[model samples]
Target chain A: MKRSKTMELGVGLFMLAGILGLVFLGLRVSGLSLSVPADTFTLQANFANIGGLKPRARVTMAGVNVGRVSAIELDTDWYDARVTLELDGALEGQLSRDTTAAILTAGLLGEQYVGLSPGGDPETLGDGDTLTDTQSALVLEELIQQFVSNMVRD
Target chain B: MIPRVIALGRHGCDLLEALGRSGLFLAQSALGWPSREGLYLWLRQMHFVGVLSLAIVLVSGLFIGMVLALQGYTILIDFGAEQALGQMVALSLLRELAPVVAALLFAGRAGSALTAEIGLMKATEQLTSMEMIGVDPLRRVVAPRLWAGFVSLPLLTVGFSVVGIYGGFLVGVEWLGLFEGSYWSNMQASVDFIADVGNGMLKSLVFALVVTWIAVFQGYDLIPTSEGISRATTRTVVYSSLAVLGLDFVLTAVMFGGLS
Candidate 1:
């Protein structure tokens, strides 16, 4: 019985170590979250394609992550993707009415993220307003198909 | 010529008989399943196979992860794409290494033990006695082991992948001096939910079934002798490992085809 108990304890410790290792790795890779004031507000960006966009996907402005995709919904009438993005509070003032939200891939076949191209418009987009002029995600498969077609034509 | 033909025919008949018996055994286990006794046995077997094997899985996973990162970094550096190491490590672990390695480990450890135990029981006529006593051997024995294998294999594979990714990160960032931010960013960007993790889980499930079925079947049908039991045990490990590898290749082909 004592031996069995010791074995059980050993096994338990091993499992705990594995779990802790995983958690530590996850935290390191994903980073720990600190609760901060909601300085950045969320707004919807309508797109014809979202590609492979998922929640927790980064929202970048000028190649820096300002926020993340908060949610995604499908537009009922047009069947377009409506992506909600949270912007950093500091950059909220900088986002003008003419800011173009384009779904961009980080690298070849990389994850889709929302890239905000801030425009020099005098009027700024108000909170909760949708960005009307949005560029959809570039589908790699479609691009390849088009490339093949062009090559054949040539 | 006629005598040689007769001998060949006899050998073929024996082979057919063995195949028929194996099929019968499979059907018997399947038909006898879903009982209360079977469920309890299955739970116990799962605990043994899954819960007991955690330590071995973790250790192997960590080492495998380290190796993957080191190898991937070395190769990528040559091409000026060292930054892609994290994504390569994560994708490989999630889709291929974790599930296959975990299943192989299971086959080496649990598969051998299971085969030996069942073989010994058969050799001692314990299974025959259970049958004589009107207890369904399939329910009392095989189903639990089968179910335990099915449940434990996938869970162990998940544990292996998670630990492996963590290990890779540790090696890549801490030892190799890769930027922490870039490592994770590449991993997050490259890995897809369906193609990587989901594929590994599916492969693991199939591996579990194959490993347990082959091991248990070999043991249960052992000849009534010590030497026979030993041979069966050895064969069980060899056959089960081969089956896992074969199944993995087929599954990978199907998954990649679907994705592409």
Candidate 2:
């Protein structure tokens, strides 16, 4: 009986430790959250070409991360790449209607992200509002082609 | 030529017979519910399988992480992307190495022991005595160990990944002078919970089931002799290790081989 008691105690501690490790992996290592932030709103932008933009990529304002790219899909009506940005609720009413959204890379070769530059317009963009002014991701091949064509003309 | 053909056919039949028996063995040992005493037996087994293996898992995980960071730092520095070390280390450990390495170690540490213990019991006719006394040896002997392995391995894998990530942090940030904030932040940004960590846990779960099944089945099905016990113990380790590696490839292809 005494031996069984100690065995039970040891097993209980082992189980606890195992569970703690899993919880740590989910929360800390993977950065998963149990609850979504209550204050978040989505804004839409359309690009001629988004290049390699993926969902969950960062959305930055002046190089500071503000939110994430929640979704990217084709705008069937416009034949353009449509991106949905889930931004912090605090900045919901601060962005102007004419704000420019550009697809930018982090470094010489890095993952692509969406960068938002606020505009001079006083009209605030609200939930689900679409940004009209947008710049497509820069393609190196196209730039090279244009440079070669200009050189030939010269 | 005739003798060679006969030998080939005989080995084929033996392989089929063993495969069928193991299938039935898995079903019998895995499907039944445990009685009250059986619960204690399971707890005891968990203590043996999980607690006993923790030290090796942790120490090896730490060293593996440190080595990865050092090697990744050297390579990434050449590309001027040394800051991506955290993302590289976390992804590699969470997605691939931790679960695979932990399962390999579990096969060696606990799987072989389970086989030898059961094999020894059979050799001494203890299992036959249990049957003579009306206690089902399959329920009393095999089920608890199987359940213990199933519950223990994923936990160990998770523990391994957590320790390994910190080990990388120790080397990359503290020793190598990479900024601490970017190391963690970059990892957080790239490592998805469902895609990387969740798939890793699933892989360990499958490996746990396969490894324990092979261990117990090898022991129960072996000839009751000293030499037989030794052979079964060796087969448990080798078969489970091979199974873990092969299954990892299949699972990775299914989980991450996205067309898009």
Candidate 3:
């Protein structure tokens, strides 16, 4: 049986639209983004206990990401986690010398990243300045152990 | 006891024989896939199979999304993490529900229809008459449908997932009064395009092969009678559904388990 060519073409276009919609959704929803931030200045923070705070984790200020963790090492002298953060050049002077970098979990069970809560200070942080105040990840196991031990003592 | 043993041996042999024959038929249909007319016919069949099946898949996706959000919200509230509802719903759809549910529905709707249509054509002697008139039934009839099933299902699965995510958004944010930014941001943060979304598409593509093969083969081999057509149609659904679920488990185990 001969079918109308126009209707078939229309259906083909409809099919194209559906698949394109999926492609758009996949790009938008699935964060397989490849664009990397290159124009960044490096900063460092020292922590007593990093606790699963991985490299490439976002370094955020005021709940907005301003940098990413570039590297993590152990300081032989202080025996602490020495993390290097790649702060965006656009946010160069936004952070002050007293901007405290704390390792915080995204959600209760989610991954750990560096968060900044600015402090009262007239001094500003330069590209290579080390943040003096740093808080480590709150280990759930440690908290639970403390609670259990305190309860047992009571 | 001797007769029972003989019947069991015969049944196993019949199963193997059908499998071998289907493999040959599948290859032959694939060979006939390149003709221009075959391509046009395939698009038409896709219009029938995919476009026609859109409403049910989207509606089911919508409801499935709403239910996931509602349930996720109820549980997440206890932990004070109700904001991750979008991540939960998106993960559920992309990782599991979209491919598996869409394939099952495709089997139920398009697979059975293909089987029944071909079986009826055989019963009415249309396939036989077409072959007698110098038209290769494999090229003209079977190949187009097999191609359509291949082309239609993954696209349908994509559409289903899209609709389902919106459905989750509607229920999770609008009705439940959750913050909208968290819904999208949490999803963007949690769901990986490669592992979850990309693998979901792979699962659907594999299912399309399984389903269309079963549907077309059942219809082609059907006996030319009303009872035979009905039985073939029923088998198309049953067998395709079982194959999809079983494959989904194996695929999930391989894709996700090997990752971590």
TM-score of each: 0.70, 0.94, 0.84
Model 1 Cα shift for residue B161 (angstroms): 1.2
Q: Which CAPRI category fits model 1?
A: incorrect
Shift in Å, residue B210, candidate 1: 0.3
TM-score of predicted chain B versus true chain B for each candidate: 0.91, 0.97, 0.97
Off by over 4 Å in 3: A32-57, A67-101, A107-111, A116-134, A144-154
Best by TM-score: 2
lDDT by residue (A1-154, candidate 2, tens digit) is 1246777777787778878887887787778888977689999999999998999999999999889999999999999999999998999999988999999998877789999999999999999999999999998998899999999999
Ranking by TM-score: 2, 3, 1
Which of candidates 2 and 3 reaches a greater DockQ?
A: 2
Give per-residue CA lDDT, model 1, range B1-260, as digits (tens): 99999999999999899779877887778564387656556555655776788879889999999999998888887776777878888888878898899999999889888888888888888889999999977778877787777777877777888778878889999999999888887876656665566676788888988888888888888886989988988898899888988888888888975745
Worst 10 residues of 3 chain B by lDDT: B30-39
In the order shown, the candidates' DockQ scores are 0.12, 0.66, 0.47
List model 3 lDDT by residue over A1-154, tens digit each.
5778776876677688677757756666875555764678888899999988988688888889787898999999999889999998986776777889999998787768899898888778878889998888899899999999999999
**Lowest summed-lDDT stretch of 10 residues in model 2 chain B?**
B251-260
In the order shown, the chain A TM-scores of the predictions are 0.76, 0.86, 0.76
Q: Clashing residue pairs, candidate 1?
A: none
In model 2, what lDDT does residue A41 have?
96
